[model samples]
Target: MDFSIILMIIGIVCVVVSFFLKDSSKKIEKDLEELSISIYQETNSLKRRLKVVEEELLLEPNFQVKSPLPNKTKSSINQSFQLKQTEAAPAKNVKPINEILVRQVIELKKQGYTLQEMIKMSPLSEEQIRYILTNNGGIQ
Candidate 1:
């Protein structure tokens, strides 16, 4: 019932409370580490998906326009269209665009060449030229 005894009792209670707090802090730290690891894995997965989507976009199929005929039979027109498509099958083989070509497209855009002119000068399609210009910050 002295002041020193009261202080000793208070110190013992503080030590007991700190032991419990230490366990809770360890649990909190473990949870934070797990959350960070999950976030890192999800970020890597998203990056991989984005890369696949970009590759798919770059490998777009080729489409050709056909002019309307004034007076052609349906069967004959179908046959002719099928034949033309078969003949042009090789044209559908799209090649991957290289960095050099992308840079050239960017340079062409900077030199004030029209989109159509760029398409004619380069082997790339109009869409590819536009994509290069837009992605490379060449578009005004």
Candidate 2:
């Protein structure tokens, strides 16, 4: 009796599985057919458009469209002209490097002068002096 009951349960599960698979397969087949039809329609439309373009090209062999340049404002044009003129002219107010001060800084550091003392005597910025000393193996 127990064996008969087990067999009956297995039969019911198999029936349920078969029903699910059968419905899914039909739905899949229907979707694939619709997709193929859509693809065919798009391909036909593209072919028609390409043929039209080819015909237009054949009718007018030298047909060309020129793209217009971007419009420039008056102020922008004036600014660009001024920029070119300024670039052509020599730059004024350029800072001159003080070679004497650089030499003095190196000399002071060689004499074991502390960074604070060097900053007090030199015209260089603290960061500039620190960079010089560190790069020249004068200080950590």
Candidate 3:
């Protein structure tokens, strides 16, 4: 074959290969875009779940409900006290701290155990120990 004919054949082969590669590259690009979208959606879902968990953790267990009645008769006072106790009971149930663990925390506080020492001794977190102590008239 002539050199020019050989060169023409090689150029044609190159063009054919480029066409095949172009199609495959387009498929790969589409797959990558789909993967990116899936990852983004998963990240958003995880963030939403984390936000809900944070809100639950930050909720106070000992919030008091004020009475609607302004009058202060002895009977009314007793009724109000009972109402307050009932309302507080439900709030306590919302965040179910272990009674045994709470008593342990209080006892440790009474024994003058430091916060860091209590954290090391107990299974509960620092925040949990602090909350128990503060609510039970222990040190801040």
Candidate 4:
């Protein structure tokens, strides 16, 4: 009779422990879901803030975002920064070489120029001319 009582007690303890564990597991899952949602929202907020800062940077004319080393002299920094500014300025005015070359290649292709002739007249390589012709729905 004492043995039977001990078995019943063990069974009751197991059932109570299982219910407690199940409830705690559900609470843990709810907390994790809340944390995941919070992180996703924060990430999107950071992305929006970054886009605003980038737009502001682009709008400012004299704001040079320099990446000079901490130990660099001011004169050296000025020289390097000026060089970058000058190089970046001209890029806005000139058309890309590829766009110009593609137009020239299209004209040459229309004129029945051979591949070798097109390659000789333009700075583009033979492969580049062929690629442009093939991809632009021009002659083979």
Candidate 5:
């Protein structure tokens, strides 16, 4: 009789412990469900905020609108810069440096010197010597 009574007490203790374990499992599941619902709500709020940002970006105004002005076109700007570079090149009556060289070659050639000979004796360019020979006393 004593052994049987001890067995019954042990069985009752096991049953009580099992009941408490089942209730704790239910609480854990309920907590997990609440966390899932809160996370879903936050994700939906973020999606709504993203849509509002997209709408704002689409409807916003641009700052660099075009305006009419005489100097705004490319041709007018280029013309202004070109006008600055051109300061009316000097008057044309004076003999250029090449003409002066040709005059020297002619004087030397008239003193009985061939072109090959003038080539060695004078510092005038070959084109100047040729111009002097070919022009026949005309001051080109």
Candidate 6:
């Protein structure tokens, strides 16, 4: 009445399945020996084939490793003593106003100056200072 009969039936079924599983596995051990021999022969043959291919490849000329200088004529390259001058781009010495202002603020702040003192040293007005400091998330 307490499901003990059902549990015992399930246990017997599991035991029967385990016995069948064990009996079935005895056949595979014989087959595994044959499988092992076949696997060994396959591996040995593959190794021999790979060795022959490697030896053949070693005999051939490796074209990729050749020096490219022999193909290019020496006269085609610049031989004249004229110094190779890189065209100088006239540099724009301009920096963003806000960046310069931020750098000045950080530098002045690092030097133990208050935010107002840094603002005073900067060329920007009170309004510009407020905006940059606020954007940069400085004091207020």
Estimate the TM-score of every prediction.
0.43, 0.38, 0.44, 0.36, 0.37, 0.27
Question: How large an RMSD does model 1 have?
Answer: 10.8
Q: Between 1 and 5, whose lDDT is larger?
A: 1
- Expressed as tens digits, the lDDT of each residue in 1-140 for candidate 6 is 65999999999999988876756556788789899999999999999999998776454422223323332321212111111111222343222233334445656665788667866798765544554445444431
Backbone clash total for model 2 is: 0
Global lDDT of each model? Answer: 0.64, 0.62, 0.64, 0.64, 0.57, 0.53
Write the residue-wise lDDT of candidate 5 on 1-140 in tens digits. Answer: 99999999999999988877757777999999999999999999999999997676444422122323232332333343334334333342222223334445767767788888888876655644564566435432
Q: For model 5, which pairs clash? A: none
Give the runs in model 2 whose Cα sits over 4 Å from its true position.
16-22, 61-64, 67-140
Lowest lDDT sum, 10 consecutive residues, model 2, at 66-75
Residues 50-79, candidate 4, lDDT per residue (tens digit)?
Answer: 999988755543343342323233234334
- For residues 44-107, what per-residue lDDT tens digits would candidate 1 score against the true structure? 9999999997776555532122323222332343344445445757566434454445556777
Ranking by TM-score: 3, 1, 2, 5, 4, 6
Candidate number with the higher TM-score (2 or 6): 2
72-101, model 3: which lDDT tens digit per residue? 332343354446556757554224344445
Model 2 TM-score, 2 decimals:
0.38
Best by TM-score: 3
Candidate 5 accuracy as lDDT: 0.57
